[model samples]
Target: MLSKHFRWNKSRVELLGMIILSLFKIQNVQIPKIAEGIISDAKQDSVIKRIYRFFKDQLIDAVEVAALVVDILSLDKYLLVIDRTNWEFGKQSIISSDFI
Candidate 1:
């Protein structure tokens, strides 16, 4: 029967949609532009290739938060940061460090 020859397929529009969705997952736009540039020239790369580029294009949180939470999650000792003045500042780094 003709039904035996039927095959499902995703159109180019669908492929582009999926790829675009991957771009939105990054909280910013710059990385998406870079990812788009990397794969722009490909005429017919595999879906796996697109996914590889997509994941490879991720932005990681470089500031390692020395948290009581994450350490406890890992079952490590909870760090205690005590101040003599009982004053607390954010344990986060400034954006200038990200420039390099």
Candidate 2:
């Protein structure tokens, strides 16, 4: 169901799989860590650079991806829930840029 967004190539699908696997495995999402998880015999530095380049070159449409997910689930009438909240860690400054 989520395969239509990718290009017609194995590398794109492979990268997507790598990203999904890394997301499930790691709690903290780090680019270098995800790159290292890719199943290739290449050097660590090379893999890291390739990952960085892939993200830098590709334009991932986040909104479209989200829409696709919602559409897929809507067919089955699955409940979709989203929760959002904003909280400050400490006292707010009077001259803070976040005020605007």
Candidate 3:
């Protein structure tokens, strides 16, 4: 699915697969935690560096990704809600929304 939208070599494609699996396994988006969940022969630090490099080097198009996801889901019809409200949480401002 990813390859269909992104022009990535074999190693890069495999790294993305590993990162995605790690995200599901660890339930976290933090690079360090995701690295910990990745099943790799390389050292944890190496995995972390690789992940960081991937994000830094990759030119991912959000529109293409969104199209790929919509294609994968095959949703016949759905409502998309985007909340523009700004809420303060401590020192950070967060805007959350849901799709139904």
Better of 1 and 2 by TM-score: 2
Model 3 lDDT at residue 65: 78
Candidate with top lDDT is 3
Q: What is the TM-score of each candidate against the true structure?
A: 0.21, 0.60, 0.74
Give the range where candidate 1 is weakest over 10 consecutive residues by summed lDDT: 1-10
Q: 1 or 3, which is superior by TM-score?
A: 3
The lDDT of each candidate is: 0.43, 0.68, 0.84
Candidate 1 lDDT tens digits, 1-100: 1112212234433444455555666434454343453344554344456655545664323233234236437655556663434332586444333343
Error of 3 at 15 (Å): 1.5
lDDT at 63 for candidate 3? 80
Which regions of candidate 3 fall more than 4 Å away from where they truly are?
Answer: 85-100
Q: Pairing residues by index, what is the TM-score of model 2?
A: 0.60
Judging by TM-score, tell me the better candidate of 2 and 3: 3
lDDT of 3 by residue, 1-69 (tens): 777766789888888888888999999999999999999899999999999999999887878777777
> Candidate 1: where is the Cα deviation over 4 Å?
1-10, 27-46, 50-100
Give the C-alpha lDDT of model 1. Answer: 0.43
Whose TM-score is greatest here? 3
Please write out the lDDT profile of model 2 over residues 1-100, one tens digit for every residue: 3456555267766777777777677644788888766778888788778778778887778676776777766765656564433445577543445533
Candidate 3 is scored at a TM of 0.74
